[model samples]
Target: MQYINPQLDIEQLGRAFQRDGRLLIRDFFEPAVVEALSRAVDEIDWALTYRDVNGDRVLSGEQLRSLSAEQRAMLVDGINLVASQEFQFSFCTDSLVAAAKRGESHLLARFMRWMADEEFLASIRRITGVTDINRVYAQATMYTRGNFLVVHDDHVDAENRRLAYVINLTRNWRADWGGLLHFTGPQGDVLESYFPHFNSLSLFRVPQQHFVSYVPPFAQGERTAITGWLIAA
Candidate 1:
């Protein structure tokens, strides 16, 4: 992605989301934080993968398949991972969940609140036109490197979630290296192809048909991001 702007005002980003039901905000995170996250990604293990719909083993340095019985249990119990396609990636980490459950702060918990900060949520609500969003339903939190999210929409009839907010954490990404978030409008037109750039935010209305392409990465590099939804509070 080319350098367009270095700043993203909350008000402008919020309005964009409200009008289009989706918006991409570039440079949404502080530069230092972005650098810290990139370093952190290097420290985390993201070597896990799963077979995509095409029966191909989807590999990523930012995501991995659940390894332990506890991890799988977390996915099924609505505490750790949330269901997407046929798998669940990490949202908040185990330590984070443990801390919150024990009334303490975890790294993952801090990240979640940062993404849902006042200005950020305002931008999301404006984009999604979601009223009383505090009624936020389910939030699927996780990190991914090259793991692909199969083409689909958020649960429409599932009475809780209403929107999907995908925030990019990787820096210096390219189109051919894969990890692009593609969206299809109701009319069947490809509406958006958001590149994976550091500190960028992509907010879309619930149930809009979309898919993450399986394009290979640049020599096994990572395309990291955190994804989840806002449900009724």
Candidate 2:
């Protein structure tokens, strides 16, 4: 199946990427392919992903519901405290990376398999001009009201991350709704921000200072995306 829209001008996209460190291509995916991908996202179980004073945390729905009132309150307090002063976030995530690693035959796993294939990676290479990207790691994300991600440079040296990407699946996301991907300057000023365009593909170099802006209570719907990195190992 052709997941990518054949109408894309890849050469133009490459020029944009070279001129800037990042680029967002709208209507990047084929409509039929996007429908299937969206359906898969709707069906997958998502674990609550967040950060607290204890660091990264992933709580399944069942596990969260099982916590005693006081335990749950404590967890909330811990996350809030960390959010007040340091890096923190809360969202839903399911890893395609894990599925593929385990040899799963599910649709998401097959999608990951296709992504790691040369046919897909070659297109990414053509755009980014980073030929060593031999593999990919992807995860589904759902950012709802009050969920957020604080700024962080994707600089972990051991991860072999070359470029980061987000395949935005949320339809009709407004800029004012605030689930935007924001890039900041060294002085912490907003350099550029991108709305989550439906069926769009966003690509940015690694080690970039960026974050998903907070989704406020007034936002209408959840922001969904397939996010990951091109690996060079």
Query: How does model 2 fare in lDDT?
Result: 0.88
lDDT (tens digit, per residue) of candidate 2 on 45-133: 77889986667889997887789999977876787789889988888899999999999998888988999998889999999888899
- What's the distance in Å from true for residue 161, model 1? 1.7
Tens digit per residue, CA lDDT, model 1, 67-177: 467854543344212334364332232222333446545454555545445655554565456865653322222333334556678775756677777667776667776
Instruction: Kindly provide the TM-score of model 2 when superposed on the true structure, using C-alpha atoms.
Output: 0.94
Model 2 residue 2 CA deviation in Å: 1.6
The most accurate candidate by lDDT is 2
In model 2, the runs with Cα more than 4 Å from the true position are 67-73
Stretches of candidate 1 off by over 4 Å are: 1-7, 47-99, 102-106, 114-123, 126-128, 135-146, 186-189, 217-219
- Each model's backbone clash number: 19, 0
Model 1 scores a C-alpha lDDT of: 0.57
Each model's lDDT comes to: 0.57, 0.88
Error of 1 at 198 (Å): 1.0
CA RMSD of each candidate after superposition: 8.1, 1.6
